[model samples]
Structure formats: C-alpha cells, structure tokens
Target chain A: MSELHLEISKVGIDFPTPKGPFCALQDVNLKISKGEFVSLIGHSGCGKSTVLNIVAGLYQATTGGVMLNGREVNEPGPERAVVFQNHSLLPWLTAYQNIELGVKRVFRGKKTKAEMREWIEHNLELVHMTHAMHKRPDEISGGMKQRVGIARALAMEPEILLMDEPFGALDALTRAHLQDSLMEIQTALGNTVIMITHDVDEAVLLSDRIVMMTNGPSATVGEILDVKLARPRNRLELADDPEYNGYRTAVLRFLYEKQKKVEPIAPKRAEKAAEKDSSKQVA
Target chain B: MSESTTVIPTVSSAKAASKFPTALVSKISPAKLRDIVLGTCLPILGLVFFLLFWHVGAQHIKTSLGTFPGPKEVVTQWNNLVAEQKDEYAREAAFYERQEKRNAEALKEDPNAEIKVREYNGRPTFFNKIQTSLFTVLSGFILATVIAIPMGIVIGLSQSLYRAFNPVIQIFKPVSPLAWLPLITLVVSSVYVSEDPMFSKSFIISMLTVTLCSMWPTMINTAVGVAGVSKDLINVSRVLRLDWLTHVRKIVIPSSIPMMFTGLRLSLGIAWMVLIAAEMLAQNPGLGKFVWDEFQNGSSDSLGRICVAVLTIGVIGFGLDRTLLAIQGYVNWDKSAVVR
Candidate 1:
C-alpha cells in the first residue's frame, strides 16, 4: 500500500511507421508515490511524450501497461486528465466554460448550478486565471490558455494528472510563472503528476525526482536523479542555489554523455517479420 | 516611409496634403472605401450600361415577327401585364362564379359529385413558378443533408468502406443533373405509376437531381471533416474513456463542425443551381420551365420576359447562398480567422 500511486513495469512501445515498426520506448520501469511530481527529461524524440501519452492512454505500451493504485490501467477515464503540449483547450469555449465542461463531465449528477460555478471559479482562481476566465483561448495569451488548460484538467479532480509539455508554447518568463503556479497547485492538491518535458531547467525546478530518458528509436530510462531542493522553492532563488546546479549538471551529463552507453537498433523491420504474433502491442 | 516620417506625434497627418483626400475620404483609406463601393458599384453600373445599350439596340430591331421592346418599353409592358393579370383574374372569378351557380343548379339532384370545370386551369402563375422553384430547392437541400451527413460519417470511420464507396462517388459526382433527370423521370414515372397518372414525375426528377448533384460535396467534406479531428482531442476523449455516443457528441461533431458546415453550405448552393438546370432539361413545372416556355414564344417580348426570369433566378440563388452562409457562420465554433 505504501509503495507508489503509479507503477510502470518494463513498458515498451513499438509502433509501425513508414520505414518499419519503430521502437519508441524500451524497457522503461518507474514508480510515482502519491502526490509526487515526476518529470521525464531528455532530448527530442526520446519518447518522454510517448511515455506520458501511454500513461494518459493516448497510446498503449508494447510490453506493459500502467497500474494505478494497484489496478491495471486499461482505458482512459476522466479519473486521469491530460494537459497537452499545445494546451488543447477547445478554442470554441471560454475559460470558465472549458473548466465547466470538464467539471460537468466528471461530476455529472451531484453538483447544483451554483456549486458548479463556484468549483470552476475556484479552480480558475487557483491557476491565477479568474480575471481572464471569460476569454477564449485565442483572445488570451498562450500562457493564460495553458493556465486554463491546467485549471480544466485539475477541476476534473483526477487521481493522476498527466501533463505533456503543457508550457512549451509559452515564452520563458511566462513559463517560469506557470512553473511556480503548477508547483503551488501540486503541493496544495497533492496530485500524483507525471509531466514530460525537454526543458531540463523546468524539470529540475518542479519535479520531486527527474527521470532522464535515453535517445531513441529505442529509448529507456537512463538515470533517475532526486531533486533534494527544499519545498516552497522560488524560481530565481532556487536558480541561485548551488544544489539546483548539482542536480541540473547530473541530468545534463546523463542526457549528453551517458546516453552513449545504450545501444540503438532498427526496430521496425523486426516487428514486420514478426507480425503473426498478434499480441505484439503496436502502440 | 519617407512621406509619413513627420506625422509621429500629430493627431492629423503631416504628409503632403494633396496626395491625400479631404477629411471625409481620408478617414477610411481609399482601399477600404473601394472594397465597400466595389461591392455594389459594378453590378449597378453594369445594369445601367446594359439598359442604355439595349435601349439603343432596340431602335435597330426590325424583326420578321415584330418590333423588339426597349428596356423602357419592357417596363411599360410589365405594368400593362400586371393590369391585364388583375383583369384576367376578375374575369376568371366571374366566370367561375357563373359556372358554380350553374353547377349548383344542376347539383339539385347530384350532391355527392366532385367539382368539375369546363377546362383545366390553375396552371402555375408567374409568381407561382418562382415559389415552386424556391420550395423545390429548399426541400431538395434538406433531403441531401439527410442522406449525406451519416453516410459521410460512416465513410470517414472505415477505410474499406471509404475505398468501396470512392469509385461509386467518383462515377456519380461528375455526371450532370441533366443526365440524371431523364433517368430519374422515367424511373419515377414507371415505378410510381398510378391509375390516373397523377404524379407530375417532374417533381421526382427535380428532387432526385438535387440529391444527386448536391450529395458529393456534403459527403466528401463531411468525411474530410471527420477524418481531420485532432489526435490530441481524441486522446482526451479516450482518457475520459468516453462512450461512443459521448465521443461523437462531445468531441467528434464539435471538432468536425466547421468542416461539416462547409459541406452543408457547398451542397446547398450546388443543389439550388443544379435543380434549375435539371428542371430545364426535364421540362419540370418550375421557373426553369417558365423560362423555356417563354423562350419558345416567337415574339419580341420573349427575350425581355426571359431577362426578368434570369434576373429572378440570380436574385433567388444569391439570397439562398447568403442564407446558408449565415447558417454556416452561426453553427461554426472556430469563427476566428484561424482554425487550429
């Protein structure tokens, strides 16, 4: 019971591409305790987003699936909400309405009209987006839209929150502000979060532990570094702290130099010849 | 850049004043004004110039049949025709009333009999032609929508079904409504055969033509729309683990709505235009028929009457297209300039 809220046991993803069945993820195993913020950091196409997508059930793993709270994860449900890289808020909806949509879908029968409005507004305010709640995704800045997306997902009150580079589209300053907001929100809600990003700095700032992934077409967890920085960490203050640099340096070394230890292979050609084995998870 | 350099802090422009217009014209740029004025200007000018040319050309007309009516003469003829129609109705009413009285007198012995006149009347009046055309256009548009949307969804969902249907669609899409009209007319007439041959069969031809011609755009566009729904959006639906109905209602339709509306609008315009052309070919009892009948008359007034019919078709077609476009705008969620 005390082990982890989320568990991935030897998960692999091999998908058929035009070239062949290419391997995206390779023999990756990880665990997240309840309320832990875990970030996957790696170079582009290292399958960090693919891992997050698998957790989100946007895709499935070839060898393994995720288990949440000791139950095997099969399908996507509202209990697991996603924040996409592009902040895929339904552009047609206002911020309040977007959050309301998630709320209404998740909490269908119990809440009264006033209660629903209060819930939506409360989440919007949590993301510091109460004032811009009426704005559509296009009318507001990219950062604001992502805040709305975060609010919308959290408002669903999912058991696990999966974010796939939710702030990649925003400018640096805005990204920093959101990072703080996200950390505060995570601390308050105690959500079991698995966020994927290429930004090593973002990962170091936000995650309780950072999982650095190897370069793909066959990728795996190369290293896991604990972020031993103190709580309620301020971005600029943490940047100046020497401990943050130590963790960042470890991640950088693993990403740039230590990646050479993993062997790379052509994954597609193998999958095609073995297509008769229908159980192969072409995720 | 050089001319506008001095105007930085001023409320008014400090440019060479002659290059710009007075206060009123300068308020909105000439380019913007041109856009507004151009919308109405060319059509009005064309009408005026056409009338002038016709009026001059009318003088040279020495036809074997009779003198052709000028635009002014046509306006006078139209007024006289209105008067003649009123008189005709009055006479016809009086004639009907007398006939009714005679029938009533004769019906002293036969009260169960149907009302019968000496001649067949109620052939479509001029206004009735336009009304029937409008009715047929709208009804056919609705029918096309009913068949196309679901079919499009099916095709969009299945690769094999899409492949199977592709050849059928391709073959039918380019075939003109005129080609379909006779096939439609003959089939309806034979299959819908009745004791009295009461069905016009023209109605069937017009409706079928509308369906055939309009179906392609709606089918193709709706399939494309459904296919183009974002993968990320679908993932949200999946993670929410939505039911099939919920996926369609919450995600699929909303995402595909803009494209669906585009399909509907395109098909409607196509149906409206095609119905008229189809009617003309099939000799259907519609505005197209009215024009054909007018053209067949060997009189100088025929072309002028044809001109009126042509004008009405254009106006009605424009009105329908605008109405559909308005609906498209209303239904579309991504109303901003950008889709993504």
Candidate 2:
C-alpha cells in the first residue's frame, strides 16, 4: 500500500458573528491514505463540510493545518478538485465547455488537441453525459448538471478529489444512480477521495472509513468507523447483508446514543449547577 | 432510472425547437390570423387614437407663439422639410458640377493651376440635422463605452479601487448635461485650437457633454456587475488556479455580461437624451438646434416645423433604443432573457 496522501491535523475554524466569534469546527484530525475513500458524516451544521473545505484549502483554519502529499495546503489549486453541492457549473457554459475550461487550465500545451478532446470526451462518457454535452447548465436537468460537475472534477485528474455533499441536492433515485457511477469510477481510477455526506447508507456503501463528528458550535471528530465491506458492493445485495447493516448500525449508535443531546450546552450547565450544590454541602 | 433520465433530454429538445422564430406558429397552423391581428392591428389602432386626440386638442389650445400645430400641420411641415432636403441635395450636386468644370478649365489653361474643390456652404436641412444628431450621439456613446468598460473592470476587480472611486462616481453621476454645457463649450473652444479642425467647437462641446452625462450608468453598472459575479464561479477560478487575465476573460466578463448590457442600454438612452439637450443649449447643428431655431423664428410655420422636429426626435430615440435592444439580444449569452 502507498503512504498517506492527506493529513488534516488539529484544524479549528472560527467565523466572526455579530455576537462574537463562532466556532464551526475544532480540534479535527484525520489521515487518508492513497486510494482511500473517506466520508465525513454528521447531523446538519456539525461542520462536516467545513472540514472538507479546510482540506480543499477553500477555507483557512484558525489553528493547525492540512498537509497534502507532505506539502502544507494554504490555497486552492488544480491538484485538489472539488465537486460543490450546488453543482457550481457556470450557467453560461455548456457541459463540454465547462469541462474544457478545467482541462485547458490543467493540461495546457502538455497534450495535443486531439488527445485533449479525447480526454474531455472520455470524462463525459465516464459520467454518461455525452448526449447533453452541448446543452448549457440551465437547459439540463438537476441530475445531469451534477453529472457534469463530477465529470469536470474527474477531468482535472486531481491527486485528491474533495466532494461536499455531491449528491445531496438530487432526488433519491438520481442520487442512487450517481452513487453507483461514483463507486465504479472510484474502483477504476483508485483516486483518493474525501466526501462529506450525512447519509449513513451512502457513507457505508461508498467509503472505506467513515469519520463521524459531534454536533457543533465547536464540532470535533466523535468516532472513526472502518468499513471492511468488500469492493464492488451492490446496493441491492447490501440491503439484507448483516455486515453492511452492522457498519450502518455502529455509525447510527455513535451518532444517536453516545452523542445524543437535546440541547448542546444546556445539559452541561445543569450538570455544573448540581456539582456546585454538592461542593457547597461537602464544605 | 433510465426512463426518468430519458424524459429530461426530451425537454431540452423541445426548448431548442421552441427557440426558433418560425416556431411561433406554423403557416399551416389555425391561429395565423390572430397572430397578425395582435401584432399589427393593435399598434395601428393606438396610433390612430393618438392622432385623433392631438387633432381635437389642437383646436382648443391658443398659445402666444400661435395655435398649437396639430398632426395635419406637422405632417405638412414634414413634407415641406423633405422637399427642402431634396432641393438642398440638388444644389449640392450642381455646386460639385460647377467646381469640377471650373477646375477642368483652369487645368486646361494652365496644367499646374492651383484649383480647389471646396464644400458647398448651404443651410442644413431637417434631414441633415437628424444625421448630425445621430452621428454625435453615436460617437459619444462609443467613446463612453470604450472608457467606461475598462475603467469599470479595473475598479470592480479590486475592493480598494472601488472604494477610492465610489465617492467621485457618485458626485459626478447626478450632474446634468445642461449644467456641463457652458464649461464644455469654453474648454473645447480654448483647448481645441487648429487652423483646419476636423470637427467644429460646438460639435465637440455637445459630444463631450453627452459623453460626460451618459458614461456614469455604464461605468456604475459594469462595476456592480463585475463585483457581483457568483461566488461559486470565483471559487472555481481559484481552484483552477487561473491567471488574473484568464479569470477575468473566462469568468468575470462572461458572467457579468447581462448586467453590463443593462448598463449599456441605460447609458445609450441617457446619451440620446443628453445630446438633444446639449445641442439645444449649446446651439449645435442637430434636431435640438432646429427646434430652438424654429422657436426663435416665431412664424406660423415655425410652430408646425418645431412640431415636426419634436416628432422626429421621438421617433429617432425610439429607433436607437430598439437597435440597442436587438444588439443586446445578439450579444447576450442567455437568449431567453427579455431585453425589451
């Protein structure tokens, strides 16, 4: 096996709100090896996406840092391509043109025009978006638009692919279809990936390891569950498989049982008040 | 899943089909008569009603200049103006012929004779005034667009530049063309010194005044548009590590196009409006000068002629706006955007 490809060590991010500084993520650490698929899953507003953005270098961490291939990540570059949740494809450009934009930037003068055309076409075909290549983003369906977004990310041939809820906006069936295609592509390319998703099944089926986060104001990693599921896992076959269900259950337990609280800070305050009374009686 | 995905491509194909002009309704379709009536008949009816109102209102009004000229009087003056234009053109042709004949005779008598073919000094007709107005306004508009677009891009790219420029832009934006005319006229005449100038001082004054008043909209709109480019697109550019020039050309300009065109359309409208006022106040040779000249003459026919000039200005302004609207449709990426 190859050595570690990405290391995010003790990253904490803070945003200034009108009230004061708001902590989005805190004390987060994770290491992803080459060709590894890691999913960061948590409830909404748990800073899972924030962690992904930090790794992608879209957001700067207030404390700690991210090291990609032994280099400190400070800014975004072509080596790390991101598939945004909204499918951020330019509305003015066609799918082919959008893909070409990244390809031209990454591989300018390195490949012949014919080779570049094949590269773009191959990527489109990878996501099965060849038929809608000529249509602009507005003219395509939400699902097709997302496929083009994925195709664009793949076309860049990044060392590590970062996706922030790539299929979060699509309908269930479309999302499932995209997930299957993603699994196939991941198997074929063996690219390192760090995806942020909330779906337990999606995390289990697509990831080698799932990194769960506790609920935020200051969210941190709660647990890391390793999925030992076999490669080429089928969505239908995994429905009844006990091993697959076991991984899903373990994640659900960590999220719902161990980390469950109605209010993030109120319970802690109540416990502090009880401790104060006990201390007064002892004195 | 296949069935659902197949369903979406049909929608795109249908949209593409509907995008054609002929797809409004086929020749074989049953609603052709309705389309024609709605398109042409209603507009004609509105014009007829307007003419009726003008004719009826003219009878009741009594101004010191004279009774207000109605549609009939205005049309008669318009016909007279057309005849005058034709007569002026005939005189110009005769002037050229006489010059040519004199030049030939001089050359025949003395092979190296210093003979010149000078332009005819004749009174400009109504049509000539229209031409002058169009030429001046378009020159000013093109000048404004050239300066405003690049300036706008620069200011939009940097927050500090925008902040530095914002106060100056806000101050100058509201200054009227009328107020600027006197200063422009003095500066133009004093600075534009030449024995044989390509353009007259008055023309320069009017053009500069129009440029000053009209440039603000385009500049402001461009700045706003460039600054308002989607954050997602900005992120994409950052991730791609595109150079500054490439980022602007590929992302900023294309995304800001719709807003930029809106500004251009507004600036053109202001330029046309400002040119007329600049011409009227500065007494440059345009439709504005014709109107002012007619007012000074104060003859019975003067009112009618002034009416004709007013109507011509309105029509030309409409035509210029329509031309820009058509251009906006052509240049804009979003074809479905309603430019009108």
Task: Give the Cα lDDT of each candidate.
Answer: 0.79, 0.88
- Residue-wise lDDT of candidate 1 within A1-283, one digit each (tens)? 1457899989998776555667778899998888888999887667787788678766668888899889887667777899988888777778998788778878788898899999999999999998998988889989998999898899999999999898888899999899989989988888888898888899999998999888776789988998989888888887778899999888888877877445334443344333323222321
- Ten contiguous residues with the weakest lDDT in model 2 chain B: B19-28
lDDT per residue for candidate 2 within A1-283, as digits (tens), equals 3588889999997765444556777899988899999999987777787787778777788899999989999989989999999999988889999999999999999988899999999999999999999999999999999999999999999999999999999999999999999999999999899999989999999999999999876889999999999999999999999999999999999888987756666533433343333323221
TM-score of chain B taken alone, every candidate? 0.75, 0.86
> Candidate 2: which docking quality band?
acceptable
List the candidate 2 regions with Cα displacement exceeding 4 Å.
A260-283, B1-46, B97-118
TM-score to true structure, per model: 0.82, 0.88
lDDT of 2 by residue, B92-188 (tens): 9999999999999999999999999799999988888999999999999999999999899889888789999999999999998888988988888
Q: Which residue pairs collide, candidate 1?
A: A21-A268, A76-B239, A77-B239
| C-alpha lDDT (0 to 100) for residue A115 of candidate 2 | 92
- What C-alpha lDDT does candidate 1 achieve relative to the native structure? 0.79
